[model samples]
Target: MQTAKRLFFSLDRQTECVADYIEPDRYSFLEQLPENERYIPRGAGLSYVAASFGSKSISLGLSKFNRILAFEPSGEEPTIVVEAGISLHKLHLFLCPQGLRVPVEPGHPQISIGGCIAFNVFGKNQFREGFFESCVEEIELFHPQKGLLTCSRNENTTLFELTIGGMGLTGVIVKAKLRLKRIPSPWLNVQKIPFTDLHHMFQVMKNESQTADSLHSFNDFTSFGKGLGRGFVYAAAFSEEDTAPELLMTFKSLERKPTRRFALFNRLTIPAFNAAYRTLNTRLKPYERMPFYRFNYPIAEMSFYFDWYGRKGFVERQMLVPEAKLDPYIEKFEALLRKYRPQIVFGSCKFFSGKQCHLRFAGTGIVISMEVMPNAANQGFHDALDELNVHMGAIDNIAKDSRVTKDLIASEYPEYGKFRDLLAEYDPHRQLASALSDKLCL
Candidate 1:
């Protein structure tokens, strides 16, 4: 019912568009659309690239569809049926009161559940519980051509898999039934382990995988030469008896601030900052218990974390390499980091297991994610990344990929052609499309 110019931009503030129309409504929103008009569904707009941007078509905004249709707190198989527009943070608040929680906790808490499913997002504990899709019991999708269709493992199996990591290209996800886990307390028993090098870190990660419920490692990318791979590894699990007094303490959310036009992170600033950060970590206690929000969603607490990248913003590059190739691949990757010396603001390491969906970014390997600030002078950084992808046989995470080509995707994801065929069958007329789909020729 609203008529206004809609400007869509990615999280990194790199790609943007001014769309003709943006309709925000209930399930019937698709019915009013004009025939043969292309549109892309939007959630929290968390994709690092232009996946949800519609330059020449309508951008279907689903924020108004926020509603919880059903809630089952106590049962053998507890579940919650929620509208796609509901943010994960809201859902967490709702579930925490009932002593239940969703296992998959992506870093961004404000992201909508629909966006999480579209990306099949990975969590800190992906090494144990798998991607967010693993918690999905069923979904309700509205196809422009086919109308409403319910999909799950028991029915419409193919659509279920496709929609899980389909990047909203398959259809408009209206509702979803997510499985929930019962927790004794909303806190985590955290253990901070520091490592001097890549080999030591990987060894610790492998050893901790068997006992830890969640694991994530921070790398000091600014460090060069002998101190190259020095950083901290965090292993944590939900507290059972509220035994740690530190975990009971509440921490206020950090103040929100507007992004400044000036740059906060440059080549010189990053090295010095990282050096200090590493030193500060060394002074902290090896073990500490903190609230669940502090351990799982720390970045969410800092509302202005992304603003540090400045107005030019940054691109997030993520790739997954098999476990067998982890050692050598990381060694060479470190060399590339030294050669390019791109201004890296944030970096993390995670382990992933279980079978990967056709389009989902999951596998039995290690995932390396880095946020880099690029300028006109850093053209070689892009080339070096492309070469590294080829050399390491890395799989491109569709959500974070900006420079990946169709050929590179085909070379890396062999199941991509089959996924395309399935998408064609479901949306034969191509009623659903996005900038990402068009860029990778999906």
Candidate 2:
């Protein structure tokens, strides 16, 4: 075990924690270190929330445990076993060469398989493919008291469900075996359609999500008046036709870019930037072909977008609201956005469909993700958003927001008590802990 004193910050840079960071390269070493200590397993450390570190806990990083342990591509459904530390980008590169890919993927390629499983992250086509839990075949978890437990649907079923999206509170994820789907090619046929208003955007999203392999939409956050929600819907599907080899290459830098000194996405520049972005993209070609990697990891090409937020960082409030309550909810949301005008810099919408699990952020609803710079106005807007979320019966993504309070979580998640009970039953002593777990009193 290589140990050091490290200071870790959330992806948003809003929270910082100091811990004894330990990197374990071997399975035995990882298993033995968790005895009678507060520790959290950390993957790529890309979580927007502080789900991996705490002031009193040991931050056990698994970066050195990354390795492809097994592969079996013979059957109708191929499967690959990989250490939890493998990054999505590395896994994609390995699978693309063999004509296979993970159906559901998070936008950031730097995220780890362990992080995806722990957070139960969804991709563009979540309305179709569901979340990362669907792709997991088996998990090897290490609990200090339980030793090493192999969890799957047919074995240790309860433990399996709890660990999938347990927010690293269940135990340390050692390795995972994932199911993969065959791909026709490593290329994609993408189409962008512009919408006139919020309702129009919703209609377009509903129509396109039915047939598109992957679907997502971008909105003009600065246009709170007449142009509210005016933007474009991006629909993509795999294409057999070949594309340029360079476009398929994986991103070179896995580390996050350093934040700039001053924020470029302030109230003044955001409106102008949003207007120019909307006009430019609306005028571009309606149809285009690009590498699948490019479509999956759009932020990789524009790493500066996050850096532009600067040292003040940003706050992203992502919530899932049912379709039945969407119109009224969005009506309230629009009013709030207007009242909080120019504070929002980025906005997006995604479709989701699945049964709601214990605290997992998946269901039949429309997910709205809005990014805003931190300030007096933005903070007030956030507090109002919190009340609005509960009043509208929305599920605020626990993994996305760092400032979510215990009261908000208890009121929002209907299955909160059940999740807490199950976690307590599994971890009677409450051996695992993180800033998030403590904040929510999990």
Candidate 3:
């Protein structure tokens, strides 16, 4: 009875779209409703830019579909069956104690299992492993046309391939059987490396990635021209709990920080923090103790990091350039940055081995993502970046914008047209999207 139109909120209110929230436990309620052909189910609504968006009838929030459902504790498979709406944070808890981990997790734990699969997400270990889709054992797809169907690598191989990173366009991922990674312990042994400049940072990452079990960088290109590549790299690997395990905090204990406290003060913190933050040398810094949850995506602390960008909303531009172009791309991007002085506030480079993901963005190359805080002062600079396709020209690469217009977006990822075609065939009526979906032609 609760329709998405009655209770909806767009991820970015500036965009015109309303999601119909639905609890995972209420399956019967949805089944009873008139089936919508174009409806796309979404979780978390954390897809800041709109990757999981729909045009006509958006399937609302499904994060409550959070049941452990089934798991093979000692079975030969070593896998777990979970409802798609579970958060990555919760999923990690179930796996950690058994010396297991997720093969792919985005930069933040706030994302849901369904979101990860829809994006066919990737992570720090991508250089060696590849996208998150490789580890998924199977998925239960819900489509109005097909009704309820099973899709997996072994069974619905074509659909399975298309679903992973297909951006939820193929079908609604109701449940998934994900293969878990065995580990020695839930703890992580991580090292923080702060570079004084861009060259030093790139030089170190290329070298360390060869051995670091998993690596991620927290870098700033904001000063690229004025020497802004100075930043830190946090590389971590699963280790036998070397540190005291008391640092781990449970979900019930974790709470959202007060954003209101920083509202008036962030104007000063942005520049001041970056100044001191850029000067510190990371090499001299040694390894430190860290919890697995904290180590992977620590930025969870600054929840409002993106929203802090005032009126001129910021866009996160991400791409994967061949390793050989790592330094070249940095040089070229920085050159463009210096020319534009656009805010490259926060960025990261995670190594990956090449492979075609369903939506196809992360791959065997250098994966760089930046938080672009554009304003009246930086519009010209940001516009230049929107026009720069140099990386695609120099290397086998692609760029993705969760909020980008359909025309510009499809142009960036040629395979997107193919992706849309698959989506159309699967859901012919188009009852599952929001306004953004219609505008993007997805």
Which model scores highest in lDDT? 2
Model 1 per-residue lDDT tens digits across residues 118-175: 8898789998888899899999998777788999999999999899989888888999
Question: TM-score for each prediction?
Answer: 0.93, 0.96, 0.86
- Per-residue lDDT of 113-142 in model 2, one digit per residue for the tens? 999999999999898889999999999998
Which lDDT value does model 1 have at 297? 78
**Candidate 3 lowest-lDDT run of ten:** 253-262
Off by over 4 Å in 1: 21-23, 243-260
For each candidate in the order shown, give its overall lDDT on alpha carbons.
Answer: 0.79, 0.85, 0.64
Q: Residue 65 in model 1: shift from native, Å?
A: 1.7
Per residue, candidate 3 scores C-alpha lDDT tens digits across 1-442 of 5554533323332333444544445666556546644566777766654555444564656776888888876755578899899888888867776667777777677778888887667777777567778778889987655666788867988888887766666667888898877767657777787676666776777788877777877676644445576677777777764534434544321222223232222344655656655455344445766677776766656655544654344556676666666666667677777877665566676667775543566545666777665446666755565555533532222223444666565655657687778767766665566554566686
Root-mean-square deviation of Cα positions for candidate 1 versus the true structure, in angstroms: 2.8
TM-score-best of 1 and 2 = 2
User: In model 2, what are the clashing residue pairs, if there are any?
Assistant: none
Q: Against the true structure, whose TM-score is highest?
A: 2
